[model samples]
Target chain A: MAQHSLEVIVENSPGVLARVAGLFSRRAYNIERLSVGPTSNPETSKMEIVVNLEGHALEQVIAQLDKLINVISIKEIVPNAAKAIVHDTQPDYQN
Target chain B: MSQMNGASSLVASLEAAGVDVMFGIPGGAILPAYDPIFSSSIRHILVRHEQGAGHAATGYAQVTGRVGVCIATSGPGATNLVTPLADAAMDSVPVVAITGQVPSVAIGTDAFQEADIRGITMPFAKHNYLVTDPADIPRAIAEAFHIASTGRPGPVLVDIAKDALQKLTEFNYPNSVSLKGYQPKLSADAQSILDAAALIAASSKPVFYVGGGVIKANASRELLELAQLLGAPVVTTLMARGAFPDSHPLHLGMPGMHGTVAAVTALQKADLLITLGARFDDRVTGKLSSFAVNAKVIHADVDPAEIGKNRFVDVPVLGDLKFTIAALIPALKVALAKNRPDLTPWLRQMNSLKAAYPLGYDTPKDGSLSPQYVIERLGKISGPDTIFASGVGQHQMWASQFISYENPRTWLNSGGLGTMGYAVPAAMGAKVGAPDTTVWAIDGDGCFQMTNQELTTCALNNIPIKVAIINNESLGMVRQWQTLFYEGRYSNTSLESKRIPNFPMLAEAMGCVGLSCDRPEDVDATIEKAMSINNQPVVVDFRVNRDAMVWPMVAAGTSNDEIMIARETAPDWDSQEL
Candidate 1:
């Protein structure tokens, strides 16, 4: 299984974290590391989820995550650019 | 603006959403909400159990094409809804579930009748909310219904804290819910539609693999148009029984395990498969690697994830089936104008295969009533317009196989989850949804005992749903597996139904008109008598042969190629040439 990372922006609501975590377990996808924190915007949060899944499984994972109504946007963060993306997080995050 | 408690706001929100009726039992946490419901125009059917309320909501939604609603309290009452919520999620039924939560201050303290229901149902519900603030009641309820009834459609849950319910709040219902990232696509990409049309025009053996989404989108008319234009055969899945008419010349019946031979073989031998709104479920694909080995699939579905989740597709169209099929018809017409492939020989081969292996069963040598015959008779007496609900088991399969459905939503069963005891309550809900039409619950002896108490709910509510129990004195499907795979050990499968609480007596005790038929000749008369009684619920216990089995079955985890026409009989696949 190849390790992949996804940066997901979601409405910062109660149970949003649990909803994301529960989806992984329910669909039997393996999660390696998950880091969640409040975004610059108080209405939404950012979640950097790392999973141990192959290319096809990663696509399915992305599609499933996209179905969550609270989820705003998702992008695949390359390993090399992860630091730059994380450091450059600003308050202007838009929905 | 009127000020009221959050509980009253919840009722007002549901009423504004146009919910005519709901199902549930009142409890401490949810009791405040019941006060408004009692005086409101929206009718609330007090179910015997929370599970029944959930499944009934699903049934109502399935038949009426509207969002069904159910309510329950904290702890066990909320948790009991897990099964039906899962069932609705699996079947893509539109249902909104409301639960009362513990007081916000005492939530983590594990106060009396407290459970984190919002967290528990998160895995399956389309979306969920935990509202601790009384002011958020209207918004949460509005979003819950919007999420439940739109997109691909599934159950949604909204849990309000007890203190929030009691707190006075100003109510303002939202004109429209606006979820930032939840947009359901209604139309497919134009290029994908053209590509699918080209395939349909060029392919010799093309099969329309229809799923429940067609019915969900109300696109059966468009499907018929496309199929007739191409002169190709159509095969509906178990969840899609009524999406395509059974009597249509181009229809090949249900496909998958226990599917008709023609339907199964057409999929296996097809050059192109037009898969509409169906996920390639394991029961249908049976050893996925070997299924439809030669077919290039064009999968169109409302859920983007379902397109390539199981099968590789030559063309993937992400849109509602209603629009996808409508778009395809015109594109296919244009493609056919260029070069239409003759499908006569392919259609001939399928017809012959259908005739060679038509669905039939043998009479029991012991003179016991045949389950298949009884179901066939039941379907004939009830007619095509009648709505049929079934519990999981041999009887469920028989009901789907024998019944003729011409209209969408006529057949309602727990196809994906295969939950037992779904028939009675679901049928009750169907009756409530479509009061003018007849609704029948075709259940098994084992399945009946699971939720038969719902008969009391139906009788008291004046729902008047009819039930026919195909009693084989054992779990027939499990016994069939044991008979074939486990050396006939029997192994606790028997219910000893012969000596148990007599079914007719049990029905009468529950305030229903009960009848029993042990012999073959009495089946029709018993059904007719049950049909005649519209004043209250009716139950007819049908004593059938215990050893009967569902044939044309592909055993668990096997390939469709290994399907058996009967015990030890496989089809001569080589003889058929297309």
Candidate 2:
């Protein structure tokens, strides 16, 4: 299984986090990393979730999440793209 | 804005949503809401248990094509609604469940009669809201109904704190809901429709694998038009038993486990499968990898998640089935105009398969009634217009197979979740929803004992639904499996329920007209007697043979190619004689 990251923007209402996270647990997909915070739009929050799953499984997870009524949008962040930017900024940080 | 308490506003919101009926049992947390229900125009059926309320709501929703509402209080009452909520979620029934929660301040303290229902139902509910603020009642309710009824419909829950219900608030029912993330695609893309049409035009062997979405979308007419145009055989899934006319010329019976040989064989042999609204459920697909491997699939569904969730989809048309088929008909006509593939041989083969392996059950050598024969007679006597609700198990399969359905919303059952105690309450709800129509609950003895208390609800409320209990003295389906898999060791499957609580006496005790039948000759007269009683609910206990099992079986997780025509009798799929 490969790690994939998804950035989800959703209505920052009570239990929205549970609703979003519940899909993964219900489907038995293990989450590798997760973070959440209010976005520029006060009404909505942004959640970043990373999971280890195959391509088809990840696609199903995305589709299930997209069905939620409170979820505003979802985007897949390329794992390498973020690493490349960090590398360019500080090449010797990890070393 | 009108001034009122939150509870009143909640009821008012339901009224505004055009909900005329609801089911529930009042409890501490929900008592406040009941006060307003008396003054409101919505008719509320008081059920014996909270589970009954939930399943009744599901039944109401299935038959009416509208959101069914069920109310319950916190703690056990709220938790009791879980099964029905899960059932509704699995079946994609539109249901709005309202549960009372502990006062906001005491929620975490585990106050008396407190339950975190919103938290409990998060996994299954289409959407849920826990309203703590009195001012939020109207908006929350509006959003709840909207979420439950739209897109791929399922159960939605709204839990209100007791204090919130009691607190005085201004009720301003929203004119419209603005959910940024909840727009369901009503129509398919033109290119996708065209692609599907081209596939349909080119394929010599095509089958319309119809599912419940056709009924949910109210697209049966469009489906009929498309099937007539393409001249492909139609196979309705269990969840979609009545989505297409059973008597239609191109219709092959239900497909999957316990499905007709003709329907299952056509699906197995088809070159192109036009799968509509039906998910490729494990029950339907049998062994997933080997299932219809040669068939190219054009899956059209309202939910995109369902398209490739199980099987590979060659063409995915994401939209409401009504709109998808409406768009496809014109495209298919155009495609067919150029190169029309004659489907005569394919249709001929389907007919031959259907004729060779027709759905049948032999009469028991003993005098005991055959369950299949009972169901067949029941269906024939009730006619096609009657609504049939069944509890999950052998009886449910028989009802699906024996009954000839010509209209949508006429068949209701727990297909996905396979909940056992679904029939009684669901039939009650169906009766309420369609008061002019005759509704029958075909339940197994094992299943009947689960939620038969709803007969009281039906009797008291004057929802005169007829109940036909196929009493086989055991969990027939489980026994069938045990007989097949195990060395005939019954192990806990037997429920000597015939002697205990005697169904007829139980029905009479619940204020319903009770009748019992042990012989096949008395089945019709008993049904007629039960049917003639329109003043109150009627229960007919049919003591059928315990050894009888649902045949044409694709034993769990096995391939449809290995379907058993009878016990140890596999169909000869390799033969070219047909």
Candidate 3:
């Protein structure tokens, strides 16, 4: 089991974050790092979440989160994909 | 349809959503919306408290299979709605709660009766909305209903600012919702169905573990067909009392906590457990470590998260309960035709266990009243059609254990939330939803106090739901726990006789016909009289012995094998092993 990261896009509606957070906490999954902000599209927001979980659990979490009414799309950050996102954001982190 | 203010638009939107009725109380901020309520086709039943409104909506939804609606004003009114919303969330009841906020300008200024209801109900509700613009009202209303009724049904909230309600806007309710992220998968794939079917066919002993989802999906027929095909015993959970008819040959009754010995034992011995629409709740599973340890669990539910939330399953089929069960039938039939395991020995063992550990409670010789006797007698008198609602505590457990339900959604109780005072309002809502059904609220004295004011609402609204409060004079369930674990030092659990309100008198004060019976003989006659009243609400106070406890309990966190018949007595099934 290793830490994984994903970028999620969702409608900027009230309680959307709570729905995702509540789902994770209900199953006792802890988010190691989480961040959400407005995306290029004003109507939708982007959320980045990092959690320590195995393949099956991560798949389940992503699938469940994707099913929320406000969620638009979710993309798991593969190693190559992670490097690109990191380079674009220019956050203080190195792979 | 026409240009109208936000309040008018809200009413029209509700009518379009097929909302015939709503349970709520209007106040300062919500008063604007009430202005147009009279113009709309929707009927409003004024409730005493917001919590009562929410639970009444839950009861209505549970019976009607529709999205239940509730309305409340700002601040405390919205705050009061929090409990029932949480209750609905946990139980997966479809409820849509609308609360009025202070004017948009004063929203964050802590203006009179203003509360961030969106933030407050966020964690508990499946979805919530804070409508700031008048034009968004119609869209918000449509989305709220869509999200509330779809997938795993749950509570949704829409907090409308007062100013927005007064703003003029063009009214046109949306025909469809566009949610990119939300898609409820309603059928299991072929591979999982075949796998589960093979397991069922291979098992010498199989148990069908059904829960409230079957009731929600209205899939009791499908569940029964599958159970029969597998020739398995069925263990219905508290929330799924009537999902499989209690009198059916396969029914083993409710399992866990205060569950029957046969039901628990059958599950313990099962080689395969096919769970439908139920989470492995601690109350049902007892000690999580050993629960259904010998069984290969196949959990089928609409909620993907629930598949492995508590107990890991060999097969996790994510889909709507009805669709999933229907799909399993043909596959199970095919598997059975190829090879059917001999279940004769398993059936023999189960029958003996049931006969030996049949649900039995003694009606005292010098006889004060037995709560179990009251429940069983009520069941016999009322017939199978009666809608039984219960508040939390010992009386609730007694009702679950003694009363037999023959149809889905007939038995209603706060299983997951364990909220007290749920019965009165819920019964009223159930009666409203299913007008022909005889509705009864079986409550405990301590629980009766929490929201009994709703009884007054029922009387005023002309909803004639009968209530039978088991007046045990103390918080019996807590007292039972205190007795078992705390050396019987009663503490504050006892309700002082002199200080406690006379329940019958209280019912009378609320404009209900009130009666009292402490004698076992009086139960039959008094209950007959209570059932005969068709024109008005009735309350029967059965002042039962405070010392009486709900038996056959697996003490909290204890394994099923450690189930107790009474305070210190191991159940017969377990005693055999010892």
Candidate 4:
């Protein structure tokens, strides 16, 4: 199955990450790439959540994340795009 | 691109990430970074040694549940940090190590104090960065912090070439980093939760084996609720010392090496071992084949690698601890309330077993201070909020036994690595993390002498941490092993003539008050006096009995049932009386 990358923006808080990640886990979606950091604004953080799933399942994962309270937006950043160059450059070797 | 010093941009990025402190020891290679450290708002604590700095950062990260930042120079300084970085990695503590490397021009030419630190620390670090260009500094710092503090938190290293730090570049720090293959599984399936609940409900003897993940995921409330509802006895790992209230009826102290007999026995007897946020480390499960052999394991952890790494898991739920626990709580509550399994009989049996192999110590009639008594008294006087940071050895075990840590992040120790001299610096970090809480550094004479120089750092920062030293006049743990297993061969275990500097005198030299207690009666008074002084650090040398050994110890490679309780029973002591 092809891996799909989804970027989620949420409020930087204690349990927000857990909730957002919980959404995909409930559906049994395998998260392939997940990155979270502060956005330009301090109050919010952009989470780049990538999961390996069929195209149809990927769409549902994005939609489910968008439904969260603190979630501002959910974008499917192409997994092979230049934006993911950092991860591609250094293969995640540690298992 | 606008021109800005790489060091300045690095500092800006760190500050942007809300990092307020940098613990390190400066050297020639890192002079540029040190310059910015002084001008910037972020505070710098110059540790006596680079290793202490890394551990201090770990201590800070563990207590605050934030990414700790530490810096060091090239070669030796960076090498010193390797142990602490490895220690942090082993414990899954979030720490970021920023080290200055030799200039780009001198990279492979064997420049002065040059070392392949990035290569050295690759296995130990979650991820590492080597900044050859000035422009990469900003992105590297941001990514380093992100990698360190994120899912299944661990240490990350960023090696900046000295030339890069000195060079100027555009100060644009990347607001975000996109990485592939680093996805942290953060959610538990609803069905998995149901399955876990079913197992919990079906099993008559269920036990919750918790680790540092409980604190990391902030799932204490959920863990407590599940345990209470199911009436399952909870045994916390050494790293998860304070995850559950030590005084709770279900709290079966720490389980692993030096774990209480009751707790380890419970693990063995449990039909269902619902491991939440705990990896069955070898120390905790001495021989994996014999560990919880009869139990149906339900492992719930954020890290997927830990699922079947040690023991076979009947049900593996890969998700954040809080979410998994939250999902399981409702199901467990319903199942427990409906079925109402009479766990009272099992609990009574466990209590009986605990009573049979009770952890106790004898007060010498010849009038010598006991480390156990001192720690117990300290525990009694201190509030639940008081934090206990400990150094390795018998004193650490004593502190683990006597100290009743009720809250998560309240107890910090080098549990996985068992690094000596971890207490004082770690306590400094804990005090920094939680300024209002009473932080105590419980150290042994042998361990205290290893990093006592950090007292200057505490004094400089005016961080008032009370340090209680259990002076046994020998390396108590090793000596005990030698006495028991080696037929008292004695060889190098005796610390006689090691001549530790009088702690009180050394404390005075470091601009702090110090006290010494020789008599058992003076322990309370000494601790009180030390705690009262809030302005500066205080060190108390507690002259404990030399031959004191932590009892109820399970010999290595032995089953949990093989525990050595106290040699003799005292008139005042009765396990059932409590």
Candidate 5:
């Protein structure tokens, strides 16, 4: 199944990470790549979450994620084709 | 444009990052940074020593779950913070240490009070920076915080030279940190989770290995659900002591070096080992090759590096434990329904093993008080939420055996480090972290006296942590070994003749309430009185039987099966004597 990436912006505070992670965890969705860091704005931080799921599963993940109060924005970041190719070239490192 | 000194800029950056407190002691080398400390909004806590500063910052950080900030001067001042820094690093506590170095020109010169701070801390710290230029101060502090708070969080040191602190620079704090090689893997492979679930379903005797990562990832609910669905016994690591409720029927206490016999046996007999968020430390795995010999290991951890670091992992699921557990639970539910394996016989055997090796103690019919009685009573009074922190030796083992820590993070001991004088400071930190929760420091006579000076710190901060000192009048754990292995040589282990401080008077001097329980009957009353008083710290000197020893002890350099079931009673002794 194809995996989709969801970029979410949340408030930079304690328990925010727990709440967002808890949401996906409660639904039993598999999160593939989750990278969180501070955004340009001081109050908000960007969380890049790549989840492995089909189209219907991706919609469910987005719908459930949108309900979180701290979530400021959500978008899909396209998987870098070059990085994927490089990873494929180095099959030894594949997890 | 007007330029500010590097120290001022460093202070400004820390203030900008919302750091309200800085813990440290002032010294000659770090005097330049001390000048700017008072001007900044960050409050400076002047500790008795740099070690105390490191511990205090650790306490502050543990409570807030933020990056703990501590400062010190070069050489000895910086060296004093080494123990606490190592403690933080080993336990994965987030800490940022700022040390003032000698002048940039004095590098490698070995001048008076000039030591290689960076070189000394390189092995210990998560990341370290040596800033000779004033321009690097702001960036260094920001990077230090970033590295300290990120994945597999640990202590980060920033050594600022005297010249850099005094030099002028245009200050600009980087709003964000970008490190190329420091990315923490936060997601698991979908196939790995499925494979792990499939393995769990197929195996008849499966065990869920829980650790501190479940608490860190906040995946307890997912873990509990999976364990319940699969009907697997949960064995926790020392660090993950309370991940599962100890009272639960399926929960087989802790496993490894000092683990319960039932837990160790369960791990040995299991066919599938689903390890969650636990690094297979040597303490947990006696012999790596022999550990879980019958089991196909499925290791799941947030840190990818820990996947195959210790044992050969058959299935590796690398991701946030909460996410991984959440996904694996449903898959396991489906797998369990399809493949129904009978584990009743295994569980019955485990139960029988537990019954055979029940943790017991023989209290003197009428003599000096017993530490076992005190700890057992403590387990009863203190709810599951209560946190029990202990120092090294017999008292720590007694606490481990007697206290049923049913919740995660409730029992904080210096397990890997075996650091003495850890209980009092760690309890102070746990109390600060969870003010509403009851925090007890179970210290031995030897370990209690090591850091009893910190009673003043507790009193000053109004941290009402209850301390129960098992006063055996000697180094009990070592004495037990000397008595058993060293043929009763009893060399320097005896503290019987050594003049010790009057604990009650010492507690009073530290401006805290004190109690002494010489009789087993007084244990309950004293502990109750201490718990009731919330205004200040309380110390209860539990004068236990000097000969009392921690039983079910697996002697050093011996296998787990060679456990000593009874203290004072040898293996070949007659059963009728009991």
Candidate 6:
């Protein structure tokens, strides 16, 4: 299983948060991190969900979540395998 | 246009949206909304409880294909509406629940009767809105009804703060709704339809697995046309009980746990399964791996999310079932003309299995009545279009097995949620929606205690629906589970016979006509008498054998091979009770 981060755009109506949270709980999907915020558009909200699942299961979860009436679109954020370069200007503590 | 306050605007929105009646209770917080209903065109029925109001709305929606509206106040009233909202969500029933909330200023301060109803109902409703501004009332209501009745129909909630209702604002109802993110899939792809048709034409062993979506889509006629064109047997799931006529030669009855042997075998042996608006629910699919293993499945539903949620599909056609099935009829006929699979052998086998294991129950030498016999006789006596609602457990199973449903929307029940107190309130809603039809709530003794207060609602509103309580004096389904799986522990399950507040007496106390019939000979006559009463609601308590259990059972989490027939389970049942 691998952790995948997904961004979901849905109608900014009351209870859309609960509906998303409920889908995770009822379907027994593992949620690592979840957050919701208003989009530039006043009528829509954006949700970020990090979940751990293998290939087919993740695809099914995404499909089911997309089926929700209020949900408009979903985008999976690909992981960056490349490491950030670190500056070694200071000497080691032991030295 | 006349100037209207938030309360007037709310009531006007309901009236403008074509809502004829609503079910709910008035409270201090929601008093503003209630005050205007007196002068408004919409009728309001005062319910004994808020939960009854919710379920009544569900019942109304289930029968009429309309968005049922319900009202309740904040805090306790809001919490009470939760169950019905969850029930509606699970069953995909269309309903709009409106509740009064604490004033915006005192919302988080925990004022009197203050509760976050919008947050509480978020998980269950299709969507919810909290209107703190009176100007948003008309638009919010229009959107709510649209959301509730659209694609995969479900409940929606709108919680208006008291301050919003108190504020004066000019009412301007929106003619159309424009929600940026709430678009439903309204059309299907032609390639998937043609591919599904191809699969159907190539398979000798084919079955049309129908469900509630077909009924919700109002595609029963389309379903029948397709079933006949395909020359395949049709097996409806519990929720789809009346979607297809039970008396049709190609109809194999209900499938899954507690379903008929023919229906189960047909689904098990089918080479191509055309699943129309039916989800592959755990109850319907005993073991996902083993269910229709050989069949190439075609899953057609309005909601794209349900396409591959459970079962892997060869063709996932997403659109409304009524339109899809109607389209599929001509496509299938064309395919058949070119190449048709010989289904004569498949038809013969289905008929033989049905004849061999036809649903049977013994007429006991003793005078005690059999619940199955009572239901079968009730079915025989009632009209073809007679409406029947059922509570959860063995009685629900028995009703599905014995009663013959010839038309859609005639059979209503809590299928997905398995709610116990559903029938009483749901039947009341059905009665209100179709006043000309005879509505009967076939309930269990244990289930009746959950929501029988609706009898007062029925009596007061002059809804002359009938109720039959199969009073076996125990939680039959739970007791059966304990008997088979828990080594007969029985604990806290049986509501012993001769208990206080007997159903008949309880019915009478609630202002409904009550009748009790313990003898098998009096079963038909009692139903006849109850049916004759058209002025007020009637409740009949049929004292059934306590040890009787629903057979053809597939124990939970088990495979198709684990189904226990009647004779195989008879010896162990009631062994500990004796």
Model 5 alpha-carbon miss at residue B436, Å? 3.5
Q: Model 1, B355-465: lDDT tens per residue? A: 888888999998889999999999999999999999999999888888888889999999998999899989989999999999999999999998899899999989999
TM-score of chain B of each: 0.99, 0.99, 0.98, 0.96, 0.92, 0.97
Clashing pairs in 1: none
Residue pairs in candidate 3 whose N, alpha carbon or C atoms collide under 3 angstroms? none
DockQ of each: 0.24, 0.26, 0.21, 0.03, 0.02, 0.15
lDDT by residue (B331-382, candidate 4, tens digit) is 8877777676777777986777666655678897788888899999898887
| Residue runs of model 4 more than 4 Å from their true location after superposition | A1-95, B337-340, B355-357, B497-499, B567-578
Model 4, A26-68: lDDT tens per residue?
5566778888999898878888876776433454566456434
Interface RMSD of 2: 15.3
Candidate 2 — what's its lDDT?
Answer: 0.90
lDDT at position B481, candidate 6: 86
Candidate 3 global CA lDDT score: 0.86
Fnat of every candidate, listed in order: 0.45, 0.51, 0.35, 0.00, 0.00, 0.27
Clashing pairs in 5: B242-B407, B242-B408
- Residue B454 of model 5 has an lDDT of 76
What overall lDDT, based on C-alpha atoms, would model 4 receive against the true structure? 0.81
iRMS value of model 6? 19.2
The CAPRI quality class of candidate 5 comes to incorrect
- Each candidate: what lDDT? 0.90, 0.90, 0.86, 0.81, 0.77, 0.86
- Fnat for model 3 comes to 0.35
User: Model 2: what TM-score?
Assistant: 0.97
TM-score against native, each model: 0.97, 0.97, 0.94, 0.84, 0.81, 0.93
Error of 5 at B130 (Å): 1.4
lDDT over C-alpha atoms for residue A92 of model 2: 13
